[model samples]
Structures are given as C-alpha cells and as structure tokens.
Target: MTDLDPFTDLLDYPMYVVTAQADTERAGCLVGFASQCSIQPARFMVWLSKANRTCRVAERADRLAVHLLRRDQGRLARLFGAETGDRTDKFTDAPWHPGPGGSPILDEVPAWFVGRVEKRIDGGDHVGFLLAPETARNLTGSRTPLLTLHDTHDITPGHPAN
Candidate 1:
C-alpha cells in the first residue's frame, strides 16, 4: 500500500463538501473521494471518513447534499476542512438553506446536488455512499472551475483520525 501512495499522490482530483441531516443533527465535511460511477443511470459516489461527524449523520440520513466549491473558495473549504463539527456549528458559520431531505445547501458553492442515499459500502477507513441525484443546481455557468485536491493540500482534517 505504501508503494501506491506515490502514484496516488500524483493524481489531482476535485474536492467536495458533503452535508447530511438526520433528525435534529446536521453535519458536513470536506471530501476528496467522490466520483460519478455510472453514466446511464447517473450514479455518483462520495466516500466519507469513518471518523467524520458527517459520516455519523449520513448513516441515518435519507439524502445528502454534495457541493462543489470554486477554486477561489478556499475559505469555505477551510471552514469545513480545518474545523471539527463536534465543537463548531458549521451551519451557523456559513449561509445555507435546508435542501431536499433536510440537507444543508451551502450558498457559496458553484454547483450542488441533493441525492438520495441508495447504498452504503464499507471501504476500510472510509465508507462509500452511493447516491442518486434527485435535483441539481449549477450556480455558476459551466465555465466556472472547481476546487481540486491540489488546491487544498494544506488543509488539515477537522475530524480526528481513527
């Protein structure tokens, strides 16, 4: 696995913020492991770390909101990435609205989607959440570039490592 680290580190992928709400609890966190797994049926998967507060909320959430930040939105990224939800109310620190299934939709994101959680797959320290988009909004035009993992390399994880 150590040998693969060098290869994986060379890949520059987009980063995202995934939000979930279950009952009265709401949580969100920065995620780098997400991708469109299918094209025909339009399926997307986002991996949440087992140690993240968002993962706990997402376990019981019926739907989740996925947000794409602009390249310049590093502040928004850090808010979710560098601060733990356990001690901080991330929703209060940012502007958002209750989206479908009660997921918080961050107002500053360039694009976002509310998806129904169809399946959950355990993958080592992270769990892959398979989502089917119920609704999507592109706040910015297609020309807007998104933030990538390379752009957020300096951020430290808000959640403690397990």
Candidate 2:
C-alpha cells in the first residue's frame, strides 16, 4: 500500500451530497471525488465507490442529481454522508422530487443539477460516472459557506471497505 494517505491531503477539496434514483428505489451519498472534466461539453464526473449502496442503485440510473450543501446543513450532510443507504432511508427525512430518469432532486439543497450519465469508467475501487449537464439551476439564497472536506474529516465514511 502507498504510505501517503490521499485523504489526509484532501482537506482543501469541496464535498457534496449526490442523489440518484431508479424507479421507486432511490439513494444518496456524500461524495468527495467529483469535478468538472470538460470545458467545451461541460461534463462533470462523480466517482462512486463500488462498495457504496448508492453505487448499486446508480448502476441502472440514467441520470443523477448533484447538490451543493451549505455549512449550516451539516446534519443533512451527515444523513447522506455519514450513514449508509443500505441501512437507512435518507430520503424519508428530506424533501425531494423526481427529475430526469426519475432521479430525485433534493429541494433543501442550495443548488442542483440533473445530468445524463454519458459514460461510466471502471477505475479500480471506484467507478467514474461522467455526466453531461442536461439541466442546472441555482437556488435562491445568500452566499453561504459550503461544506468542505475539512468540515467532514472527523466523520467516518458512510460506506467503508466491505
């Protein structure tokens, strides 16, 4: 194994809670590895660990909804970020609606986007879901501090190696 802990240096990266749905089954997880990959096509990529319950649901998902949560929503982040969807219904406690491919769009989020999964690449432990921005909208709110990797460093991963 590598001696360096990549996570130790991830403090500066932004974090987000990403949600997806396939029919009646829905799931969400707090993700740290996501970013824009293309400038011309505006493609964004979200890496889901193979062990995550959300990854199971995402296999059949046609679209995914990504959200940016504010710092005040740490509890919300914990619900999705610190808890495994395999044992908990994270959506039951939040407000959501169906979006592209029947994916759930959380209303409590500060901003959201519905993207079509154009390609999925197997990247060893995690798979990258490349999304083409189908639609995006910003919620009305004052500029608020976003939840960051540093803010969640103390919390254990919702889905650890299994």
Candidate 3:
C-alpha cells in the first residue's frame, strides 16, 4: 500500500461537502471521494469516511446533499474540513436551508444537489453512497470553478481516518 502513495498523491480531485439528516440529527463533512458514476440516468457517488459523523447520520438518512465550493471559498472549506461535528455545530455556524429530502443546503456553495440514497457500498475505510439526484442547482451560475483537493491540501482532517 505504501507503494501506491506516490501515485495517489499525484491525484488532485475536486472536494465536496456532503450533508445528511436522520430524525433530528444533522451532520456534514468535507469529502474528497465523489463523482458522477453514470450519465444516462445521472447517478452520482459520494464516499464518506466510516469515522466521520456525517457518515453515521447518513446510515439512516434517505437522502444527502452534495455541495461544490468555489476555489476562493477556502474559509468555508476549512470550516467543514477542519472542524469535527462531534464538538462543533457546523450547521449553526454556516448559513443553510432545508433542501430536498431535508438535506442541508449550504448557502455559500456555488452549486449543489440533493440526492436520494440509491445504494450503499462498503469500500474499505469509506462507504460509497450511490445517489440519484432529485434536485440540483447552480447558485453562482455555470462559470464558477470548483475547489479541488489541491486547493484544500493545507487543511487537516476534522475526523480521524479509520
């Protein structure tokens, strides 16, 4: 696995904030593993760390919201990436509204979508949540660039990796 570090380190993917709600509990976290897995039916997949609070909440959630941050929104990235929800109220600190399926939509995100959880796949330390997009929007229009892993490389992980 150590041999793969060099190859993996070279990959710089876009980062996202995934939010979930179940009952009265709400959680969100910065995610580095997510992509559009299908085009015909428009399916997306977001992998959440097993150790993350958001992942725990998502286990019972029917839906989740994925948000794309702008390149300039480093502060927002840090808030979600560097602060653990176990000790911090991330939703109260950030401006957001209840979106489709009761997922929290961060106001600062440039683009976002609410997706129904289609399936859950166990992927090592992370669990992949296959999503079927229910609603989507581009708050900052189409030209806005998304923040990538390179843009957030300096930030530390809020949740400990399992």
lDDT agreement with native, every candidate = 0.92, 0.85, 0.92
**Cα RMSD to native, each candidate?**
1.2, 2.0, 1.2
Q: In model 2, which regions exceed 4 Å deviation?
A: 1-11
* lDDT score for residue 162 of model 2: 31
The lDDT of model 1 is 0.92
Cα lDDT of model 1 by residue, 42-91, tens digit: 99999999988899999999999999999999999999999999999988
Tell how far residue 116 is off in model 1, in angstroms: 0.4
Ranking by TM-score: 1, 3, 2
For model 3, the local distance difference test gives 0.92
Per-residue C-alpha lDDT of model 3 across residues 1-162, encoded as one tens digit per residue: 588888989998989999999999999999999999999899999999998899999999999999999999898899999999999999888999999878999998889999999999999999999999999998765677779999998998887755
Clash pairs, model 2 backbone: none
Q: Per-residue alpha-carbon lDDT of model 2 for 84-120, expressed as tens digits? A: 9888999889888887767788888888898999999
* RMSD (Cα, Å) of model 3: 1.2
Q: What's the residue-level lDDT of 103 in candidate 2?
A: 78
Distance from true position, residue 152, model 3, in Å? 0.9
After superposition, which runs of candidate 3 have C-alpha atoms over 4 Å from their true positions?
A: none
In model 3, what lDDT does residue 135 have? 95
